[model samples]
Target: MGLDRAASIADLRLKAKRRIPRFAFDLVDGGAEAEVNLRRNEEAFEEVLLTPRYMVDVSRIDTGTEVFGESFAAPFGMAPIGMLNAFWPDADLTLARLCKRQNVPYVASSAASTTLEALAEAADGNGWFQLYVSSDDTVTEGLIARAEAAGYEVMMVTADVPAAGKRDRDIRNQLSVPFRFTPEVVLQCALNPRWALTSLKHGTPNVANYADLLQSATSYADVQKTLITPSFDWESLRRLRDRWKGKLLVKGILHPQDALRCAEMGCDGVVVSNHGGRQVAFGPPTIEALPAIAEALGGRIPILLDSGVRRGADFVRAKARGADFVLAGRALAYGVGAGGRAGAERAMEILLLELQRALGQLGVPRFADVTRSALSDMPASQD
Candidate 1:
């Protein structure tokens, strides 16, 4: 379907799958292991039924909200996506500009194909940085310092990926670095001329932020080994917290104890994510994991939800289930994959439109007003 006909994030996904090569699409679409948690992420959200409070003056609806002294046009924002240009040439800068225009937070991934500095400038003051926490302390420190120099206010450290999740699709596709041109991949590219031609014009995306270190690496495997921080622990977190000197957040938090400890230790917030079901196959869906984490924090920290949030109602469900705010990576990636900038714009339009309708339908004035009281099928916890 054309962008004009694409009405939902799912439609965007379908268009993307048809537009890009299998290996390329699967890189964004596939999750870890059997992808059980991926399916669970959306299914769990679907099971949450929001009940309307009816008879209230629902003539007006405003979805605008704020986080960390920043006002967003909507309650949600874009999460970091690594190698974003692989989906569409210049997608990283495109999305950063999109976030600026949309008045939402734009997080630049450490592994992004575009430099953090460029993304920061494109995203303007709404830019945030997400760290993968390299095995080398010097590299980590340099990245931290560069982000600060670029004027990033918020820095998020990923906690779930001590080692990379074994994504099965990458294995089957022989998805390797330096753009492996298997006959099948070549054929897929041939079929999708728009993606192929654009990719040719832009060149293959790489780990732009880590160019210095990556240039010295022999293979992608070596690159992965050098980057993965298996030794990162609470001590490492404390050290990072001491060094960043910005609004710090820990992403990939599921356990309540971990969330509470992060709050106590002075983290500005925590992104309650399963890495969009990409990191852990066995972890609980983020929606189901939210309440206990919320109760654990007890309003001590901001809880941002990520994973399988496609529709606008999904945003409301996440907030009602206890997320202070929500973020989506694949949803936006699907947009770029479908058609570049216009596709990404459509994704945001679909989400914002759906979000406003959801709030109005639920009779909630704003995102913060959506409490667990909106929940129906899953009864309130009788604490």
Candidate 2:
């Protein structure tokens, strides 16, 4: 389907699946073992029903909202996605540019294919940086300095991934960084000529932010081992907050206690997430976790929701459930994979239009006007 015909994020996902190789698509599309949380994330959103009040001034709708003292055209922004180039070459850059043009925020990942500086330049300094703590304090300090130098105002430290999740799809497909051209991979690449040609022209994707550290790492295992710090904890967050002067947010927070602790530790915000269900299979969906965390924090820090936010109603549901803002991952990833920059823009356009329509339908003039009163009872879980 053409970009114009792509009415939803799901449509973009279908297009992306056809455009990219199976292994590459699966890396972006699949969640952790059993993917129960993955499906639950979307299912939970459906449980939230909006109650529209009629006879109100629904003519003017504003999707705009302020986050971390920065104004965004919409209440949603691009979530940080690692190895973006695995789905589409230069996908990180594409998303940065899209967010800049759309007047929204883009969080560049520590494991992005493009460097933080490059993404910052692409987003015209509207980019936020997501950091994965390193085993080496020096490396972590260097990354913080780079982000500060690049002019990123907000820094998000991912707290969940103490260990990597077992991604069965990736293992089955034998997907790896610096992709090994095994017979299966080679055949798959050959089958997807467009992606293959683009990838070939752009060269292999590497963790651009960690290029210096990855130099000595000859294999994917070496790269993984050198970068991930299994000992990441609250102390690590305190150290990061002390060293980094920018706004600090803790990502991958599901428990309300963790969110409360982030507030106690002086975090600027907390992203209610489960690493997009990539880190845990049975954890509660981020949507299901947001209200409790938001209540626990009690507006002490801004709460951003990620995972399973696919449509405009989903965005409204998040806001009504107490999220200050929502973030999209696979939505834009699928867009870039489908048709590069234009596809990315298309994805943003669909979400914005849907958001406006949802706000109007719910009799909410702006995203801030959405509240728990606008929602029906939460749906009971099937299982």
Candidate 3:
């Protein structure tokens, strides 16, 4: 089906599944262990009820929002996704350009398949960099310097992944960086000719940010070792906060205390996320976790929600529950995976339309007005 015919992100997801190899599809689609947290992320959003006020002037609903002192065309932006090109050829650059054209933020991942400089160029002023905080201090400091030189106004330091989640699908697929091209993988690629041909042309996606580090690094294991600082702690966060001159946000916050600590330690914002349910299988969904953090922070700083935001109403649900802004990785992932830029733009267009319609239904004029007050039931704070 064409981009216009794709009604929902689910449609695009199915389209992507059909077009890409199963192994590649599962790499993005699957989550850790039994993926209970993943399922809960979406299901929690379902349980959130909204109270709509009628007889109000809802004619002009403004989805435009200001976040971290920057104006955006919408209330949400594209979340960072690593190895995006592995799922769709050149998807990293595609989504970056998509955000640029759409006037939304694109958080460039430290692990993104394309170079940060290239994505920064594509995103222009709309780019924010998400850091993984490598074990090497120089590498970590160098990345921050690069982002600053590249004109990224914000750097989001990820806090959730101390160790990589063991995704069962990847294990089953025997997935390796630069792709091992085992018999099964080769056959799977052969079955999905479009993906196979496109991937062959794109070359195997690698850790582009670690080009110099990986020059001597022998294997994918060696490459993986160069990523993510496992000993990262509150001291590490404090030190990081001290160094970055621009706005800084701590991602992967679930508990209110952790959220409060970030705020106390001077983080510009906190992204209430479960790492898209990829970090832990039993963690609370981001939606379920937002109210407490909101109550704790009491709007001291901006709050951004990441993970499981598939539709425009989901963005509304997040806003009503308590997110100042929100971000989603898989919408653009599904978009690019389905049909590159057209598919991504279609997905974004669908969300923008959905958000406008949802605001109209809620009798709210602007996304900024969407708060816990919009919740049908003013329930007690959630832990």
Q: What CA root-mean-square deviation does each model show from the true structure?
A: 1.7, 3.0, 2.3
TM-score against truth, every candidate: 0.97, 0.96, 0.96
lDDT of 1 by residue, 176-260 (tens): 7556788999998999999999999998788899887787676667777656689989999998888878899999999999999
Number of backbone collisions per candidate? 0, 0, 0
RMSD (Cα, Å) of model 1: 1.7
Question: In model 3, how large is the Cα lDDT of residue 258?
Answer: 95
Writing each residue's lDDT as its tens digit, candidate 2 over 1-383 gives: 79999989999999999888898899989999888888899988888788786777988898889988889899888999988898999899999998998899999999898999999999996799999888888888888888988898899998888888878898899876556789988888899999999999998888898887787776767776656788998888888888888899999999999999989999999999888788889899998898889899888889999998889888899988899988999888888988999999888888888888888887888788887878766442311
- The ten-residue window of minimal lDDT in model 1 covers 374-383
**For each candidate, what is the lDDT?**
0.88, 0.88, 0.88
lDDT of 1: 0.88
In candidate 1 the C-alpha lDDT for residue 298 amounts to 84
Alpha carbon lDDT at 221, candidate 1: 78
User: Looking at model 1, how many pairs of residues clash?
Assistant: 0
Q: How do the residues 1-383 of candidate 3 rate in per-residue lDDT, one tens digit apiece?
A: 88799999999999999999888899899998889998899888888888787898998888889999999999888898888888999998988898989899999999888889999999988999999988888989899999899999899999998888878888888887545778888898899998989888988887788877877876566765678878999999999899998899999999999999999999999999998988889899999999899999988999999888888899889988778999988877998898988888888888898889989988887888887778878754520
Question: Candidate 2: which stretches are off by over 4 Å?
Answer: 378-383
Q: Pairs clashing in candidate 1? A: none
